[model samples]
Target: MTVENASAPPSTRRPSAERAAALAIQHLLSRQDAQGWWKGDLECNVTSDAEDLLLRQFLDIQDKKTTHAAARYIRGQQREDATWATFHGGPGELSTTIEAYVALRLAGDAPDDPHMAGAAAWIRAHGGIAASRVFTRIWLALFGWWKWDDLPELPPEVIFLPKWFPLDIYHFACWARQIIVPLTIVSAKRPVRPAPFSLNELHTDPRLPNPSRRLAPVNSWDGFFQRLDKALHAYHKVAPRRLRKAAMSRAALWIIERLESDGCWGGIQPQATYSLIALRVLGYQLEHPVMRAGLASLDTFAVWREDGARMIEIAQSPVWDTSLAVCALADAGVNPDHPALVKATDWMLGKQILRRGDWAVRRPGLDPGGWAFEFHNNNNPDLDDTAEVILALRRVQHPDPVRVSAAIRRGVRWSLGMQSGNGAWGAFDVDNNSSLPGKLPFCDFAEVTDPPSADVTAHVVEMLANEGRSADPRTQRGIEWLLTEQEPSGAWFGRWGVNHVYGTGAVVPALIAAGLPAAHPAIRRAVTWLRSVQNDDGGWGEDPRSYLDEDWVGRGTSTASQTAWALLALLAADERESEAVERGIGWITLAQREDGTWDEPHFTGTSFPGDMSLSYHLYRQVFPLMALGRYLRAVQQGQSVCGTSDLPR
Candidate 1:
């Protein structure tokens, strides 16, 4: 394949390598599942576009009512300048604004429609076409709204870098790495063509005349990374023919091996999905079986309804949800023989990874022993899942000796191996704190890195303690780190769940497990902090803003899940007999619906502190079960129980 002449006017010539890449990508696509779905990055947020589109489709409100309602929601979100934010009331992001505007257009609003004008005006006002993120620009370029040269190069050769090197494939966080792999091929090819429509009004300058030079200052980290990328591009251009071919082939195979049957590299998340598509455009063929299956898999990810069509989540949470539910019920004092408990245990036992997954890289020689968020994501198995799964399994009566023993050993080993040198554990991988990845200018968005954190470490300690191995040095070190990590305000910064409530809920139990006296200063301080935050509603709820604003700690409309979390912390501290625990349990019981479930409208789980939020539907059921079970047990032991009459009006 000949390099496209940067000096020569844009040519129609298709490089042979580009064709080969496309064929390879298409081949990858053919491997998708019979169900039309492609797994990749879901790109989660408070205003998840996927959720908005899903609601529209599910309600079958394609008529003016639906349009008007959604439009009202979208319009209300627009800033004074007409741009919308990915996060609540934050700076306007071009991609979010673009998606929102497109949704509005699909809602039957015309370009000149006042709201439409306002959005377009805002897009232009924010450097319009020029100021968007690389991913955003890539989408626009795909349809000819933006030029290819304006983007950074992503040569596949970068994948060949050794794990020890800076900017190596391994240096990137898993989420970022997944997208970058396919993007490398796409960037190197730099394919551009015309689109069906013009986005002239969306740009501050004519698309053709718009400057394509790198945006960040050369002295800045982003600029440095960009320059390094350009150098990689030059190296790819002149590399030995044999070496280049081998690198590309290796990269292609690496991607193919990881392709889930659902046409997604991992599951139908957007990053993997888009990467799959980019690979296809690079010349992968459909009949190659892998590509064919992958393409078919993409179809399963599409969710169509009367109002509009969007993507179905590539991943689901039956295993994680059920396990957490089982634990919650058991902790709440539900009989181990409860039908739900038995079923959940049976399901979880069947779901254990008996063979090693990608985690084997850092934790080699350990048997596969962790649970994944989705039933299928073997490669991205989580440390938290392993801990929680083991905890749940331990509570089950009559677990299979062989399976339980084996799974626990594997999980314990994995968790221990995942501990960083600093004696803490991260959610997924260990030692994922490269200084370079986050410094890249292109990574202005939050969450380009992962490090060991207090919450995950506490979970590890609790799990180890349950295994009767709390005295182990590794476990002791983790406990020590957690004790040190507590905030001056007496709370631990929760990395995975919502704010202080989650951190406190996790820490108090872990401390208790580690043999902290109930009256220990740290324990008492945590108890006092929780009690102070209890709402008049006799429940506790903290907004996501708690991640940003300390003053907002424990402030929000009381919800069943948060209340349960607070209750769990109090109970773990031997405070189950306290007025606060009684009130908290009452609030949860009162909030329960006739169906035995509680209302949980808010997303309580977070990934990259303050950026992406998640709602585990089972959080409401499980946490309350845990709190109530603990409370009931304490009361059965002659501790005072809060009466239903004491619940908030």
Candidate 2:
């Protein structure tokens, strides 16, 4: 590994990094929408596509075109072992395989078809439908393939719980809360559409469906929740008819009030699907206006490919993508007032969510001015997007200076006010670190609550420093929290991106931007840990398995986004000329495709660490450009790399 000579003459540094960044900038520009937003395809698992087919089947609206297209996409995702994994190259997941199998059956594939038969054998060996997650069982119940009574109880009366209660709606994270509220209505109705065919072949034993599993120890939290679920089940039987009716009505109102303007709930697919089914259970016909609008909203989540496959995005990410794109272009030496940058800024400014959303429940006095990840979600603007958007706005010399300034100020105040009790920040809510939501049997699939994470806090700290608030007491506390959270191995746990690489990448720059010297003990330790993990290919990669198994930390096949993350950290720690940085940069440049983009099929983004993962299409382009642009600037400066203050304003 050879390090670049930082003291060499101006044009003698790594020119490939510069060349690759230039080509990447043009590629990204061409992909931008006419409306001035950039959202790459958000690719997740086959469950989104499978659940989509299930929903259409339940509503008697499953058309041949959509069914065949979705089936093609699902078939393409099947692993060599004949099952679907939640992420690329990960192990086969039982529930995912189950959902995919049922969906193919609906597409007219016979059970004995080679693919279908192989999937059923895998499912049975893996404990079959009985061992799948609670949500999958509920989907089966809708088609009368599983008994609803055997599932955990989520009564409509749960809507009546006080906000101060342990399992109240607010205790769940915003995403889970949106789905749960509507699901309570579904659970109460227990309405089942006739089955198109039996799913007996997918079960471990056709005679004894939903075999009972052993209970947890009595004193444990899981045991307590198990008993509580039993109690709720009993209560469901003897409850007064009038009270249940009123409770269901109240829950219906709650779902209706929270539906986004685009007719989706919180700009996610699963939530919208459940909300529609819940309303249909309450007597809303397919021809009703709300149902019509919602069915149309679901259509937008579908991405029809050139090869005639239909894919489903779990959610869209326009605000997140556009903000990062602007920051990358600015770092690559685009003029601050370039029409592309200005147009993106104008579009971002228009997206400032001023109306108070669910986040205001805990922060009633804080003003509402933040950005959401999706195009139309107004009720759940998160701290991560708001901070990144502010950082992006600071890089651009927009035409409406006053407008940008006000938006920045509001964003800063709201972010500061959102700090959790422990002096950190979660993505959507304040101090939403509930312990009970996780123990509930029904929430066994994925994360049910939002909690403070190192990546989110790092972004906030970086944003505050750029806004000249580095010395503010709030920012100082955030810095302290980050230092304390660092692992003995010198990495932070990434709750959003792939494991340790992402967390270290995000934290190193934030700490430096907040005035920590390159020699700071924490910064040096992080740099050392990153250097140790450099892959044999001169890049960095951490598998999604790192979230589950300890040995997989900072280990996996190299990917473009993860490599850029590592490079960003090294460059921020004043190691631009180090061998690790040089080699990492070389790997990224050499890996570039002819189109100025890199092909990364791995899941680098996270929704629920081990259970759900994401492949943000724009991540491959934006992050590498940011890393290379900073390297180019460091070469030009002959010393320190370009920090936020050095960028054009």
Candidate 3:
């Protein structure tokens, strides 16, 4: 589909690189509002669309228009083998396949249809109803397709667990905690609605006692958890009714407390859906203010594609996108007092979360001045976003310098205080390094813990250095951590993006920004890695497979955004006059479309690495502009290709 882009300037007879860079910068500026903000589609996969339909079916509010639209979107994503994948050109994911099948069935697709039959065969061959993730099975259990007793037990009493206790609700990752708290209520209620048709045909060997394979090693953590699960199940039946009721009430209160923004609970669809479901089971009516608001909020996430509608985005990225846009513009030499920057700055300033959130557990007294990725994710002001926002604001000379400094100071203190004891930073929460939950029987998806990551640590360090804190002990330790994390091949593992390319791209610049010399072994290793990964097309790309396997690290079809990342990394590492950097710049100059933007259908940005991949549509435009701008500026100034001339040292 053709998308409108930022308007570029008149194409003059300048160098190809300069012309393309100017065009891209102009186009990006054109896309900004008078208020100085930018937002692009936060596209996920069909699972969201399918889940939306399932939620509608469970509520008995399935509308024909939305169903047909959503079904069309799901159908378009099914592979020839009757399965769906989490990312483009990736292997079929069993959970995605199961969810798509259920959504299609809910949309009135007959199980005997050719596509339906093929999917059924595939599902049964794999493991049928029981082989899916714990979350998937829970969804099926809601429709009477699976037995509640067969699912993992999430008692409402989980909310009562002390914060210090392992496996407590609070101890899980922030997103997981929000999901689990509401789930405890659902699991306790055990409410099952009648399905339009039985999924007997989808089960493997229906004659077997339990067609769903719930396998865990007999003598390990799984066994221990299994035994504990049995004990909990037994306790469920004999427990005092009053206590359970009180726990359910407590869970309901917790869910309602997080109903942020208009009607959203934590600005995520999954949590909102579960919150709605649990509240309904708790006897909230359809017209309840909370329910209506939640249902209305879901509409914001729906995008009507040419094929049909897709419930793709978990949440929007207004703050993240806006800050990145501002930084790119500033890098292009846009006036700091430009109305666009001023308006966007004011808008971003309003979004800083001042109230305490779950992060308060780790730093009980730290003031809240961090920004969330999404507009309404107030309780979870992430470290990455906070650092980026501070960097962006620092670029513009806002009229209210005092306010900006105050906000930046609070954000810095909050981000630094949130750092893990190992001298690195996670996107959200502190020292959230729990690996035990990932080993649970139902957690077949990728790591769910919010652990410290190279990309995040780099951002934090870069922010501190830009603010003239390069020699700060925390900043130095972060740089050291990054050095130790580098792979022997010179690439670092990307925790939030696709793979090594993203990791190296992030770490190199941050290291240089913190006054690490380019000749340093760590910096040279990373620079060597970036050069080695360059493709014949003069661009770079890392396959999504890199998230799952090491062999594919820094290997994939040449992509515009990945190329920009590699170029930026090289430039920051003093590779300005290098042929590799020039070739990369040439590739970017050649790839720019007539509209001044570049095409990147490939999923680049990631959520949970392997579990869920994302495409920040703006990446193709934003990074290239920043990279090209920095390159031209450095060349014209006759200086080294280091980032921002004001070196901290």
TM-score pick, better of 1 and 2: 2
lDDT of 3 by residue, 1-649 (tens): 1212111221321277788877987899889866557988887778888889989888888899999988988998888888898887778888889999999999999999999999989988888877788888889999888888887776888778788888777667888878778888888989999888888887776666255445467688887777777788888888789889999999898888888867887778888888889999999999999889988888888778865555568778889899988888887778888888999999999999999998898889888889998868888899999998998998888899899899999999898889899999998989888877776555666566798999999889989988888898988899899999999999888887777888888888888888988888988988888889888777888888887787788988777778878877888887887778777777777778999999887888888887888888888888888888787776777565555426221
Most TM-score-accurate candidate? 2
Candidate 2 per-residue lDDT over residues 1-649, each given as its tens digit: 2222323332433777778988999998998888889999999999999999999999888899999999999999999999999899899999999999999999999999999999999999989899999999999999999998889889889889998898899899999999998899898889899988999998889999878878888899998889888898899889899999999899888888887889888889999999999999999999998899889999999999999999999999999999999988888888888888888999999999999999988899999989999989889999999999999999888778998999999999999999999999999999899999888878988899999999999999999999888899999999999999999999999999997999999999899889998999999999999999988778889999999999999998888899999988888889987888877887888788878999899999999988899999999999998888888888778665525745534
Residue-level lDDT of model 1, residues 494-522, one tens digit each, is 88888799999888887787677778899
How well does each candidate superpose onto the true structure, as a TM-score?
0.80, 0.98, 0.95
Candidate number with the higher TM-score (1 or 3): 3
lDDT of 2: 0.90
What is the TM-score ranking, best to worst? 2, 3, 1
Where model 1 places Cα greater than 4 Å from the true spot, the runs are 1-94, 103-109, 125-127, 205-223, 230-244, 261-263, 299-311, 548-553, 638-649
Model 1: lowest-lDDT 10 consecutive positions: 1-10
TM-score of 3: 0.95
Displacement of residue 20 (Cα, Å) in model 2 is: 0.8
Displacement of residue 425 (Cα, Å) in model 2 is 0.3
